[model samples]
Target: MIEKKSITFLYRTYKKHWPLLLLALFGSILESASMAGLAYLIKDVVDDVFVEKSYEKLIVITSVLIGIAVGKQVGFFLKNYLYPVVIYRALREMRAKIYNRILRAKPSVYRKETSGDIISRATTDVERFGEISSTIGTNIITETFTVIGIIGVLLYRDWKMFMIFAFTVPVLAFALQYFGEKRKKYSKRLQESFSQYIQHLNQIVSGIEVVKLFHEKVFFRYFNRINSDLFKRQKKNRFYETVYLSSVEIVAYIATAGIIFYGGIRIIKGEITAGDFFSFLGGVLILVNSLQTLQRGAINLKALTPVVERIKYVLNLPVEDDKGKDFKGLKESIRYKNVTVKIGESVLLKNINLKIKKGEKLGIVGATGSGKSTLVKILPALITEYTGEVLIDNVELRGYSVFSLREKVGMVSQEVFIFNDTLRNNLLIAKPDATDEELIQALKKAKADFVFRLENGLDTVLGEKGSRLSGGERQRISIARIFLKNPDIIIFDEATSALDVETEEYIMEEIGKYFKDKTALIITHRLKLLEITDRIVVMENGKIIEEGTKEELIKKKGVFYRFSVISSS
Candidate 1:
């Protein structure tokens, strides 16, 4: 049995296309009526042409048969053609909704769900659900109407013969229910296994460089394990599907045989004419074909249960909170009061009190996993779950709209992301209304004038992650976006770590000129970069160990002092 929730969702999804659906429904009725008409006319063909040998009636019968065929073809065309339009439109709507939901989902959701799982639900599972829905709209509805029409003809011709066919329905229904449940179980497992398989494949592709550097045998072994599990689940699912279809067919055949044996006896005894016997048999064959199609559709719908649940899970995920006033600009200092961040049982940031006046350039130095990134992420509303108050211009950070807050803050991180689009479009992401001259000026400020040398200049496609550009060039592109954005607050999270000595110095010179009189935070291990900052903070184990000017920290001989000494050596 299909769950009521799933049925409701599908109905809501399809109800929008009711106009086309009504047309398709009418076509199904016409097609089924034509089929029954064909069976009913078999009596005339046999009785007048064969039994009575009447030539005049033969012409009338042939003409009526051709008309029925034409009507049936028209009905087939309408139903078959229109349902795809409806289904495709519905599927497109579903895909768009899923993508929108994902875009609005909180950052925590991304951490909890793998990209593979998300991609599978958005793509593979949605396509599968669409397939099942198509089957229901086209095959199931049409077959159901066909069965009803044929049953009407069967009862009209001979009630007793119809009774024999009716006896097998209960048994067929039981088989359909049982096998359908079994198939649903295996289908859920199969889908899960496929998700893991896709996840592993995604990991391999994304980390192909690491995989090549590491032991190939280990990666291959893990991949083989996932692949084998996927194969096993798929095999089980197919097994149940095949058994369900075959069971329905067997029952249909047995019922047909019983009808034949009993009808033959009736004809021999003259209780029914040859025309009546043939016509009833024709109806039974049509009914049998219709039921088989209906059974296949039922099985497909059962498989849809898991797919629906997965899609609903994603659709129901909580979106990021976006209710607040628009942040215009920074007026005073930014302050963090006892802020702490935790992921499960592990603390990412300890209680920390900090303050940075407007236009202050603060440098943060820390080893990996020292909460430096997490601390900076809070200003942009990227990390929302913290146990303290963060104030911007004396107002609660959450008081400002996240969109407006992020617009005022610019971040250029170590892992720069470049979309597979033209350089012009990529730059336009920061300032959508920027003109050609504005972009060239921003690129020049970031020391990324290499764009002019490309074959297509700004129009040149950047390829995946700026594959066409070197590491230094990609970093420059990232900085150019910051220049275009012209945010009041700037963050450099190891932004130039990938650059060589000369490029780093040139890029740092430009950044220093740009950072003058702007609030800035720089997170880097390179001590030489600290020369541009008025003060520096050193963190360790999720806590701030020391903070002061470069000379002050060096005189104190603390974490920053040791770091600077090591870099100098």
Candidate 2:
């Protein structure tokens, strides 16, 4: 993680929000100056007016003090009211930057990373960024100005008396300086440990069924011990914060005592008036204490470094951008030749060659983990770094553009992902510009028009991942989505396997109509799907084991015959 000044990042991110920020700084300075000015008027009223028996001077000084008090109230409202709104604006801006990063990320990026952690990084990371994003700027402005303005007044009252306030600031400053690194270090550790705990919490929730079936009740006990250890470590961190704040209070009291004792002697010797001596002491008390308050908040900010770092680490990560050529008017077939995939020391695929015509149905089949899905993922330009010559017409896959290929391709996977939104919107996801008439036609073609019979019709909100819908209904919607897009090519990866035999047959009939004159590719483990595909390609261990028409492959009595035998069993 890189070390950036939180204050600088906060300001640069939201300079436009500074109108409120300016108001806060102005109000704080005026309020601090008013207090010191009121103290000056008190000394004059007691000594020059009452003690010297001058009533006229008393009225004027008293009026000025009253005006300062009223002015301070107005300043306080304008200043205090501005901060939270400014903080809100800053938070939104930073959240937008994180959101934009996610939008620009390639789908492959998520495959290479953990989405659960990435989601936390976007939300919790932005929140952690918020910890520093909102506060440090305003604190630097108001606190610095307030402390400085108050101290200036104390010096003007009596430079010699100002020495008492100065001596103690260094003591508090030393405490803050002494504990700064320790506080930051502990805070960093606590944040990292908490993130790890959060990761574990997600893993357990996702695997609750497995845990239940296995009857691992004692697993929680082990997890509890780990969490308990983390809790103890966090408690230890707060101890450092306690020491930092406690030290500030100690310095403040010592300074308060030093001022009174020294000033009391000055009054007795006639070196300063009794009223002047008392007012000077009061000024010293406020100024010294304000400095202490500033240090305390800074220590708290230092305590947040770990969380801020975690957030910054993610937001600063490189977001992938689709810089591929625009394919608004593409007129070419896709070709794959000699594609190879190797991970570490393991070779997943070797020297695979194939061709996909612009409008032809191509079926890819293989055993589980045979790289069937991996091969399909490459067409969308998902997997970029592989040794191969994939061409859009004659243009190399790497030379042409990702956006160009994506524009004409649509895929429906075995594990369907549906957002919690209207049924209409789910279909419109394929083509946001599609109209109600167009949507219904696609739905009818995919045999999903039964959605209109529901209570909400197109407005029906399918729960997350379409958990509210039955397996067949979800697949129909998935098919309707691709039908709505009417892309040049479609890849169906076991899209109907979960359905009953009759439902799967009905779906197959519906899909054949949808793909009648278009290019369609189906990867199916069920032999039922093979009857629909014009050609069959059997894949074993990532290479094409055999390929022919359904009758041709069965007649060969090889891998396809063995596959049929296994299916019957």
Compose the digit string of candidate 1's lDDT tens values, residues 1-569: 89998999899889989999999888888899999999998988898899999989999999999999999999998899888889899999888888888988888888789997998899888888888888987899999999989999989999988897789878877887788788878998998999888878888898888889988898889989989999999999999989988987787778778877899899989999889988998988888778767977887887777999998988787887778989887889899999999987889999988999999999999889899999999999888889899999889998999889889999999888899999999999999999999999989987887888999999999998788899888998999999999899999999988887777787788888877879999998887888899999999988999999999999998888888888889
lDDT comparing candidate 2 with the true structure: 0.74
Model 2: how large is the Cα RMSD against the reference? 3.8
Task: Give per-model TM-scores.
Answer: 0.91, 0.85
List all candidate RMSDs to the true structure. 2.8, 3.8
Candidate 2 off by > 4 Å? 1-11, 17-20, 38-42, 45-66, 177-216, 223-245, 300-332, 342-348, 449-454, 470-472
Per-candidate local distance difference test: 0.89, 0.74
User: Which one wins on lDDT?
Assistant: 1
Enumerate clash totals for all models, in the order shown.
0, 2
Q: Lowest summed lDDT over 10 consecutive residues: which window, candidate 1?
A: 498-507
Cα lDDT for residue 345, model 2?
66
